[model samples]
Target: MNFVYEKMMGGKKGLTGFLILATLILVIFPLFLDIFRLNLVGKYLTYAFPAVSLVLLWGYGGILSLGQGVFFGLGGYGMAMFLKLEASSVENTKIQSTPGIPDFMDWNQLTSLPWFWEPFNSLTLTILAILILPAAFAYIIGAAMFKRRVGGVYFAIITQVIAVILTILIVGQQGYTGGINGITDLRTLNGWDITTDSAKYIFYFINVALLLGVILLSRLILTSKFGSLLLAIRDKEDRVRFSGYDVSNFKIFIFCFSALISSIGGAMFTLQVGFMSPSFVGIVPSIEMVIFAAVGGRMSLIGAVYGTLLINFGKTAFSESFPELWLFLMGGLFISVVMFFPNGLAGLWDDYGHYITDRFSKSKKTKEDSPEIVEKKSDESAA
Candidate 1:
């Protein structure tokens, strides 16, 4: 048990992993990739948040909530609300009958902002809502489900339903939620134009920094006693429960934590991508996000980021060259990952990598022992 824990925790191997991740996100990509490609990578990196969170929930805790998109959308919409409000300032919306409100509101024949959007006017509150709202929603769902012992596929189905309901609500309420198009035409954030190349670069670094912070936090959790409990719950819920741990509380906490992480990504996506739409708040995107986690290795948090980047990169390349084949390729990739590499790219690396390392060590030792063995044989012959 100690050996397993040491291997999983931040020993030499973990430090090497962290260093590789840091070098890629902080140094290599920024130095080599162009501004356009870098920004695109930034967008892909945003998806990594949910992927990493899914690793914690599914790989460790065995709780698969398929409605992560709902939380992601909620977080994006929270930030989008603030940015949209700023963009719809009196000067920007002078042509509208209700100049200060969102243009969508004016188009829908509304005169003022809704009660809910009023709170987003404050930046601090918007930030808080980005984290709090999704966690709160997750808490409600998780509490209800886990407390009732309704888990596995049932919890997944309920979460999917929640995602569908959110998409419908956003699309149905065009005036308030920006409808099918989502909140667009966002130019500036806090009076600084975010549409410029310089701002994109700034936001990219900010996104990378936040991602690293999340990775570190997740590492802390996985190395702690709580992480052990989560693993126990995933493997043997009955045993843990009999051991006196509130398994439901851990589930709720992890679910909410995953929601909060995903929301932060969504908020960053709005800032970098400059839009928030119902397209992301649906079942399809949520499932794809899970694929991202699965492809990365549900057990490896850093692998989640690489998995998202690789998948998105493949998507862009395929969609550009063979638009019709993109979906087929993606479906095939998902199927292959599940069928062949259930633990993902990370698992493959751990398997073959350790094997190769062991072989090399054995060869080196044999070489070193050859001289000593020959010397011993020479002495016996002399005797």
Candidate 2:
């Protein structure tokens, strides 16, 4: 058990952190928050998927991608295609000129389902698309850039540009891609109504489970030989390449893996939010995701979740009363984190948490060595 804990959980500290986060999300939040608030938290948790991926790719692997939203949107659109089809049954949309297709397509005068969207009519195919499309897209990008030794700021800029281009494409192809409004009014999944309160609870739990699973998988990768190589590549790529390692392959693999993780989040977002939009597929949300990682301690997976929740909660709260100021507030918050708390909340804890622990330990020792306690022990021994 100890060996397993050490290997899988990073020993006691890691295990404790995982358990605490699990308790907070899985138990405490559900017990305290009403269903509506819990649902919002679930949405925030979905965003954490990308944040966690950023932690792995940017924090650990030293690969900063500024367009994770691209993969996220692909996954979301895949699931949305399935749900939209389910909701647009011949019976449901008989009034439209083109029955059995998404309303948006009918509104655009599309007479038939697009060839690409045909695959999403099946739940099985939709699931596969959600899982496969993002990784494949990421592999192509990573291979192109990493193979040519193009990285750092240049790679970041390329990713941002791709995000912009993809958003423009989605917005321009109104008949096919749902345009700027995005794939909306998603209603069910494989015959199950996903908008009911009960469904919300179930989906929230599922999201939590998937997130925990992703974190564990990421942790496992971090503790393995591959993880060490990732760090080596991040720190000294030329040296690793000199050591006979195919550096680009490692970079490509992690990039693909991170894209896959983000896509899972996107799928869950569609399930929970009942829609997917091009708004989430742009450079802004992608950068906000990075801020989540940065504020949560990019080096810490669990911290990513907290960072996501904190920032999103702030956005919601601030937007309620001062909507115009929220963006500026967020920008300021990001700047503060970067300038003053670069390591993020996790770094602050690392810097200060031990002081509390030390105080408790010292008090316990003082009690154990107190004169009265020592005299009592001596008396007991003599007796």
Candidate 3:
């Protein structure tokens, strides 16, 4: 969809979105859902962060990154490291050979903490790493690819390979990263036990708050001239270059921004889910992230959140009831959505909903006018 910046991405439309999200977060979900279900929605909202970024990158910037999982993993593991350090205090690990180190490290026969893990002992440093590491990695990747005009399928392939490589590295380094199991047993953030239901409730609100901020940020960007430039680059990169814009710089910026968004989601995921695993940092999950954006309406920021919720809800429902058919069903949904509704749920609504609403309004107006017309006719006949 070629989105008109003024029409779709403007602050007015974003305000409507903000109100809807605020209502859902502050009123609807809290009042309607039990804690368990609310937490599940929180998990779904976390994925929406990355999905919104994908809408920026793929839908507007025309950059399809298949390695978003790597950034997500980096952010998640960054947070996980700090949480693990807190959980593995000397008192907690008194039975371990290395009482001050993480239990997994002790299990693997390590005597001292790895140098890389040292920084994570500080929460401030961990938060900084979570933000910087992903953006730095994205900068390198985007600079290398966009500068050389490598994009589309080739860029996508490279990203997919990167995801696979990172997954292998994390899984292979058992002693360092907890291997295929990834980071687990995270108990607390500071002194507050994050595993408690109360904590989950708090984190859910936090997730919603951050996600809303991101949506507003994205809307601000998309409504700006730079957003038009991105759309132009997506449709006509060579023309944009001919027009004297630094296309590669814009690409790099969007790439880094997308990474930042994905990382934030990852960090929030770790907080809510209580674990960060290699399973989330791989090709399958990375692609699934894109599917969330596509299913929502790649050009619609607010639509992405609803899309993630609906898809995840369906996945959870189907997988629990008919495990064997869930994959087939999900695959079919993806295929059918792409094939039949290229613009996704938002597109469908825009196309048919306006027509329905217009018809309803016209009918109601005619009904009101009929009473006035009949009253005038009776007065004229009496005269």
Candidate 4:
């Protein structure tokens, strides 16, 4: 029990923070917000998946990937393909020249489903693809770069370039990828209509549950020996490499793990948003994801979720009101966070929260001791 508490929960303080966050999303938000707002929060939480992944990858492992959207888009597209196929049944798509293919494919004059898309006909295959494909792709990328000892700004630039390239590829391959519009008109999942409010509520709960599970899993990893090694590699790669450890392998594993997490977010995003698009697969969204982690404090997994929620909420509110100025505001917010609060909200809490608590504690102690001290002094004078 002690071992589990220490290792899995990060002791008392970690457990307290986790419970507070869980209560906020699970109890507070659901109770206060309406369905539409709650659903929007669910969408924001989907983005949190990648944010949390960044906490592990960039924060701990020191592997900064600016191309997480690639994994995200892949996962979303995998699910979208299945849903689109299900929605594009022969009976439903009979009006199209190519019946049973995606609408975009028919419009593009593709007579048959692509070979790569055939497996998505089955839900099992789709799920497997969402789970495995991103990690596999990450493995290829990680091994190529890390094994070659390529990192730092070069790696970051390479990831950004990959994001750009993928966005272009998806946009260019209109027939295969649904083009710039992306895979749209996603209607159902395994014959269950996902357009209803009930469905949104259900998906929201499921997403929250999965997100909490991911956080716990990540916390477990960070508390383990392997996590310690990741930090060592991040701080002193040469020394760790010289100590007989294969540093590249650790980076590769974490990179793949982060990709897997981001892909889960992508899949959930498709379900919630009812579509996938190249807009989400491009450089801007990828950078926004990193900003979510940065604003929340990269070292703190739970903080990542809050950071995602805060930034997205601000985006929605600011965009709704200011519209034209939101982008500039967002840019300024990021600048401020980077310049003054580099450690993020979590860091601020760590730095000042204790002082507040300590002040209160001292005051309380002084109040309790006043009566006793006065009584002791009076007794001595009387004697």
Candidate 5:
């Protein structure tokens, strides 16, 4: 069960050498790169975090969860709750002012509080809830669906439909979810001085660290037996069951893990951006997240992150230069990637590895063939 893929010419080639080389490049780039670019990259990294989950659950586990945005929304709203409370109309208020509550809550004649939203006013409680809420929902849904052997487009369709329903429900419930306008224009976070550039960079660095941590954690899982079971269930659910594995359990586990990761990403996103709204966790953004993984390379976790970062880079670039062409430009970019590169940007690494190997081989052969000539020339030069 070695991971080595057999070489075309002879024995297997090692994956370790490639990984080490990649690690060196990653470590060095940040040291020399511009801080502004790193900050921009930091923003994209949070988005990529959820895309990593998309790769694992959709790319490997065969679960096309269109509701990943909901988990993200949970985290964003969680942080927003704390930020809103910190931005309360009155200072040191004993009665926690409800945050993220639509202004219509007063219009709807809500004189008192909703029991469910009470914990949101507490920073500690909100953060914990942000992590838990999405995970619990995903676990329930995954348990129900996978146990029944649901797979393919049906699962995808159901998830998408659920996303649409949730978005509409949030919109309709103007009292709680902030309706259409969505929560915006927030100022403080956990009493941290968000206005300061140094403080912002601290948050940015935290996101970068988290993004790398998630990738490493994903690699560990993907190289484990659990990952193998996930792929097996993805490719052939019935076969996995026939092999005596509880396929449902594996699917639920991955689904929940995806939710948890997505929640963290969502929370950090709001924590940094200082706002949350129904539109963010809505259907379109959810679909965009899926595209990020698909275009990046469904099977590669790093591809997902790189794809997201590159896309966001293009967005910033395009939006700044030719604002009118932004939509068409982005669309064309996705179309090009989809049509031309099935393995996405990660294929560049594979191509470069082969190129380097070929060049090294040719150089070694030249040295072997011309050893006498080389040595004679060297001696002559020395003399």
Candidate 6:
């Protein structure tokens, strides 16, 4: 009883600290920033949303999901569809048409409205679909895959194939989906005109706050006993099964939750950028999401956030300052980390703190051996 009580107390304290610090940063975030910096942080937060989810599903639950982009796309495309419809003429009400769409539909030689496109014309339905479609897909997929004991690479491949197929299908349905262009030319979202600079800033803050919420939520789940069961299932599912625990149920739970997180990220993404392209949800993008969480040291939540910030920051800086060679520059950066630091940037953080502590401990030893000389050596090493 005492152990449980103490654990609960610790959990509450930790969660409180996290919320306080996160709130502090966000509240003061706008004060110390130019619009450009604010916008960048917002973009970072948007990316961080999925990073949080991946850290849970892959990091804590030991489920490597490559089809995260599918959920992301669902949210994005769902929101985009709503925003597009909101911009259309209500008098026509049925296929009022978009600049990107009506023209393409005309070009594709389709005279009448597409049936599937009708539901997207309503904002409430789109918002509901934004949350529902991805989750429903996740549930079905999770149910089938988990119940059959399908996991690891087979699950990974199945997800990857889904992403590839979805992208191809979107491309093939040019008139309906805008083809290779995917979904862009979004003029507004909700009732607000997304064109104003202030609107952009507000949107950025909204994304950041949402990202922070996800981080806190994931942390809560990890600190709970549920997290313990997840890790057990990951490391030794058969043993867990022998112990009378249902591994499949836990796996599905995590998968579905992660899908919801990805969906939210996608929704924020479309709101901020006003674009939802197949490129953002293709096989490569799916793999990139995995690489992101992997680079963050899949075991650590802080690692996920750190890795995301590092990668996105590097991309932004290199692209802006050295447009011609940014790709090479970013590739070199990742390679350096992967080669020298096998566990990733998160591993580096742990190793770095360990190095510092070791240094101090060694210095203390040397100080006892030769008090005067130890200071010089310590100073040199610290530098």
Candidate 1 vs 4: which has more lDDT: 4
Q: List runs of model 1 lying over 4 Å from the truth.
A: 1-9, 352-383
Model 4, global lDDT: 0.92
Per-residue lDDT of 1-383 in model 4, one digit per residue for the tens? Answer: 98768887877567767887899999999999999999999999999999999999999999888999899888999989999999999999999998999999999999999999999999999999999999999999999999999999999999999999999999999999999899988888989999999999999999999999999999999998999999999999999999999999999999999999999999999999899999998899999999999999999999899899989998998899999999898888878987998898888777766665567678887986898887997899999
Residues 105-213, candidate 5, lDDT per residue (tens digit)?
A: 5556565547877887887888789888889989888877888888678888788877788788878987766677666656777666675667667777788678767
Candidate 6 lDDT over residue span 7-60, tens digit each: 432343333434444764477767887876776666666666677788889887
Question: Which candidate do you rate higher for TM-score, 1 or 3?
Answer: 1
- Models 1 onward score TM values of 0.90, 0.92, 0.89, 0.92, 0.81, 0.80
Encode model 2's per-residue lDDT on 127-193: one tens digit a residue. Answer: 9999999999999999999999999999999999999999999999999989999999887888888
lDDT of each: 0.90, 0.93, 0.89, 0.92, 0.75, 0.76
Candidate 4: C-alpha RMSD after superposition: 5.4
lDDT string, candidate 1, 58-131, tens digits: 98999987999998899999999999999998998999888999988999999989999999999999999998
lDDT of 1 at 206: 98
Query: What pairs collide in candidate 5?
Result: none
Task: Give per-residue lDDT, candidate 5, residue 73.
Answer: 82
